[model samples]
Target: MNDYSKAARAADRVRIVELDAEIQELQARIRLLQLERYPCQQRLDAHRYPVLALPNEIVGEIFVHFLPLYPDTPPLTGIYSPTTLTHICSQWREIALATPKLW
Candidate 1:
């Protein structure tokens, strides 16, 4: 029937219009998310950078472990010995004193 065919065509047109609107909204949301992530993407694009962050106390401990000390040495030599941990930088010396294991 002519009426039936007309109704079918109208229904088809309405479905197609709704599908187009849904596709357009999906594209808009994708564009918005891309803009939101643009800065983070730029940061990720940069090269890696190296850093030095070992604490002075850690350095002093390491040097103390490597030092040569004689337990039987006189107290005077213990105070003036080059092998003493404090002969290094003042900061390292202070750390070594606080961490007596360095002696």
Candidate 2:
């Protein structure tokens, strides 16, 4: 009975060591996969969308579409304002400032 109990404990310890080694291997594999995915994600982000790549003239036309029909004073605050559009990017800021129709 004593020998049987000792063997059972030894088997359990061996299994625990094997499981720990497998866990470490899986974690290393996950790190490698994440490193591989980083460049692909960066490349995808580098490819600009059609709207963002549009000429400033076209972007200015789109900005003009946001204006009120009766020529009310532009809103000083909020995301809907032309000022908010300028805050998006340097190019948009230049286009918004250049287009007098937006003012």
Compare the candidates by TM-score and give the number of the best one.
Answer: 2
- In the range 9-92, model 2's lDDT, one tens digit per residue, is 999999999999999999999999999999997767557555567898999999988776654766757876788889988888
Deviating ranges (above 4 Å) for candidate 1: 1-4, 47-103
Error of 1 at 102 (Å): 50
Candidate 2 residue-wise lDDT at 73: 68
lDDT of each: 0.63, 0.84
Worst 10 residues of 2 by lDDT: 43-52
Q: Which residue pairs does candidate 2 place in steric collision? A: none
Alpha-carbon RMSD of each model: 15.3, 6.4
